[model samples]
Target: MKSRDYSQLMQELSEAYAHHSPRSAAIHQTAVQYLVDGGSNALRTIEPFPPRIIAARGAYVTDEDQHQILDFWQGHYANLLGHNPEVVTRALSEAFANGFGLQTGFTDLLQVEVAEMLCRQTGAEQVRFTTSGTLATMYAMMLAKAFTGRNLFMKVGGGWHGGHLWGLKGVGYHEGFKEADSAGLPASVMKEVVITQFNNTEQLEKDFHRYGNKLACFIMEPVIGAGGLMPARREYIQRARELSEHYGVILIFDEVISGFRYRAGNVAALYRVQPDLMTLGKAIGGGMPVAAVAGRRELLQLAGSEHGGKVKFQGGTYAAHPAAMIAAKVFLQYLIENETQIYPRLAELGAKTRKVVTHAFEEEGIHVRFAGDRLTDLPGSSLHMLLFPYQEGLELSTPEEVRNPHVCDITLSEKVLQLALLLEDVFIMHGLGCTTLAHTEADLEYLGEACRRVARRIKPYL
Candidate 1:
């Protein structure tokens, strides 16, 4: 397949949106005022000129202009049960009637219930709640360091844990590491972090040999979520487990994205290798802000417990808020009850979507790839040239290309952009299925139709 002129296509797309709807214009204006200083939280995944979503239901979101869009993004893969699921809403409503926030007693039984369920699911004897994934991982790392009497921790290259300084420092995106994603992280902090290339067992062994004693823990995502949807090989994960046990270094599976979606537990369940600690987020709260660090009781007992007369502190005001707990409990119950049927259905949908998408791209003469476990998958389609567009006289690419390419862009730029716009429009009307428990086979058809529409548009370009 020949490469597309993404520069020219993007130029035309920008012109097409020059006179957007008044609602979209208003949203853009408001966003500029409200978010410009702080910036979008997940800026890399969103479009440069993102539409302001006014409302959402199931798998579709309505923009400020009242245009509905099929939401494959799914709140950065958090909405496993889909937007405003009845179970979540009902739980939230009941919990709100009981109370919103109280600093006093445990008025919520759901929190404990969910934690117990997690323990059963993940094989962790104990669990601690946090408000965000970052906090969960931060606590996990601190606990590992304290328990092991070591300061250094090994992390995988191109993997993202969260925004916490220590966690972010462990990521390979910083200076001195292979690639640093963020700036302002102190150089001193980066030095304590040891990073190894993903999927390379030799490097893992070498790092362990060099710094095994100094390392407090080794943290990684079972499936690389933010770094790219790269699933760790089973053998590599087993090796990590063995090395951690041999070195007395805590093994932490940062399943913030992989938890509950791929299997009931962390990817450890699939590989039959249990880590000392595991961090969970995303679907844990069923779209609410919740995260957790679960591990052996001995490790978790250090929280607020005197270990040789020293106490480890970990607390947050909203750590176990009743509303969030209730939502999580109901969501988890639904998941547990329907595990047999729901998981397989989602897997089937994912497989079907992947197959159809792969075939569509092939037919369109676009180079692309699809990746995911049973529940979800990501398409990394891109124009191979965009990686070095400037080398071929093309200085810029589409807003999405600047962020993430689908697989390849061999089709004509104009046609590809048009197809994207058309797909966005179609998604607005029919409401694409997210492959949630609520979504039927018909919904999958809608999703396929959306893909087919885009495929047809790029046929000529191919």
Candidate 2:
């Protein structure tokens, strides 16, 4: 099929998006009245308002304007069973009927059940529930520090653990710290964190040798989700484990996005490298807000004051809320019952989609990289990408010549975003330009077709 002119197509779609999205516009106006910067938050992962979603079912969301969109984003990779699945809804409903919140110790069965399930799946001895992934990691750090009597921590560069000050320090966004990924965090607070590049064994060994004594723990995403979905080499992870063991540093795996996606365990399971502590979230609660820190008995027991704990404090009123606990339990139950069928199916679908999209980009002469292709035979979830425009032999040219060209002024990034938005308009949504289990073969074909169309549209600029 002949591709349409993307710039002109974008202009036309932009007009249609404005004119046809009256409900979205009204929702955006109302949100702006209450929320700052028109109801937006940090990360700016999603496009700004007229950003209104009215309803969602399995693999689909309907905006306020009633445009049914194919949701590859899948709630930032949280909805493993897909949006509003009957199983999750039933679990939530049952938990709500029992009670939303209990001031004192009420029924602890749900919490216990979730912990037991996680332990069985991940081979962890104990688990602690938390309200969010940030809290889970923070508490894990504190526990590691308390158990080992160390003050400093280490994280791989480009890995996002959470929004906490320490986790954000090595993200390359903060100016005051040596490397800060986000602003507003104090440089003093970040000094305690040491950064190491992923897959760089020499640097990791050197850093461990230099700071192992003072380092409390080393935390990293088994698969770097936000850090462009970079997967660590097995040798790299195994080396980390050896170094940590050698130095007495606790190793923590932040599996927030990986948990319950490929398998009930995680990337750690796939890599066959065990960490001292594993943090989980995203799919654990089946679309609810929940996270966990699981570890060996000695480490987890540090949190309990009754056991002569050295760890300070970790629990909150909502730490083990009945609703979230029940949701997690049901989600795990579903995973256990359908593991053989569900996991293989997701893997097959993911592989096919990656192949189709990669081939489409190659045929169109677009410079795009898919994480799914890079991490093939690896049992994990989430299909992500890092896209750049083909530079037209610009690499061989001198810096001056490359910078002098005004044609390069219009970035490939703008075109990519425009194409993504166009896909959204036609009912295919991406989560920060990534796909997930919610997508089927037909959905991926839809995306591939969209890419072909987009390539044609941007051919003139290229």
Candidate 3:
């Protein structure tokens, strides 16, 4: 087994995925006429085609073909309470019945409640609402720039801040994290944005030293999500704070996937590293579409005023839709009240699943290294990283070390394994998952069994 045949594995996974969702394959064929690439998002892809999830409940999603897949992605890492929790569903139903859904012409108390909760949790004096993580981050960055009176941005390489213009650099870099990520991005925008390696203090120092004067903000996640489930070292965070303070630059934490991810989604607070400004999403709405940018009152005041002081920030038509705000209020209030129960359970389940999956891989002679395994283990975070080493003896001594795409290139393998596990009736996204309150010991058992079965199929390659 010099190297397990990737082609054969891909073919097997492809056939299995196609076999599991005949209706999805058929509908996708029709969908291609309207939906680009037969899907709305890039991560919706699997081998051959993607499945149409007709309905979901708890930890399972049913495909159009009547197959139940045990989901681990959990609504793109937002469904911390699991899919359609009874409380949220009941609340949503009532709100809809009361004509609170869609774009209500009048403002609602739900928005105020959710925003207040966010402010309390993240220590932000003011908060603004949005419908997506990208929007929240865009506003956060813009506010940072306006407050600091700077023109450039600094960010962690491989960090995903959204599809917005300023956060696009260094995301898909193969050679350097600072390289231009997208093709159509303006050369000037690329020049204005600088990328630094996560947890790499020297790079942080260098970037801050050079760009500090013109740097609008240093935006990053306390725990990396798409770039890698890598967590920033405390030393790195401290150094970033020092540099930002010295240079009068705003430090913004994109807590989209991390907020309440651990406890109430304020990941920066867990490490006692308070960001100057922070964005919240995902779990905050408990599967609903909601996001927010919150921070110092002084910086936030620069947005939406009669005089239009420095920054101009405001929500869109559907920015704080009543339905989403209602759902968010219910979700956030529930977490705040049951903080002890939910956060600890999430941490426990996360650690247990990691162990179960890792043991199965090793037992089958598979070489896997979970990036940010330790970081996601913190109090309330439940992000799961499945890192398969390119070779057997690779060293993954630090979080940033494993974030390197070359050393831990699971691009193809992640697809293959994602499908392979689907064949085992377990659903996940590129081996990335977040445990929720809905996940149980039985779910973990089922997931571990699925991993073992998939590992058997991939034993040769591992």
Highest-scoring model, TM-score: 3
Candidate ranking under lDDT, highest first, comes to: 3, 2, 1
Best by lDDT: 3
**Candidate 1: C-alpha lDDT:** 0.64
Residue-level lDDT tens digits of model 2 in 1-462? 132334654565556566777777667677767777565554322333444787888877888777877666677678876788788788677656776644345656778888999999998999988888888999899989888988899987656788887787756423212466667988676678998766567878999999998999999876776544556767778999999999999999999987777787767888888899999998898887789999798999887866675675465667777767767788889889989987887778766766676677679876654432344436444555434423443321111111122313223433345434444553323222445556777877877777667666555654
As for candidate 2, its clashing pairs are 6-457, 70-427, 173-180, 173-181, 174-180
Each model's total of backbone clashes? 15, 5, 6
Which has the better lDDT: candidate 1, or candidate 3? 3
Q: What's the residue-level lDDT of 350 in candidate 3?
A: 82
Ranking by TM-score: 3, 2, 1
Candidate RMSDs in Å, in order, are 6.2, 5.4, 2.1
lDDT of 3 by residue, 280-359 (tens): 88888867888888988887888867437566676677888888887888888899898899888888888887888888
Q: Return the TM-score for candidate 3, rounded to 2 decimals.
A: 0.95
Off by over 4 Å in 3: 1-5, 374-380, 391-400, 403-405
TM-score of 2: 0.86
| Model 1 lDDT per residue over 270-322, tens place | 77889899999888888888899998888887885556524254548778777
lDDT of each: 0.64, 0.69, 0.79
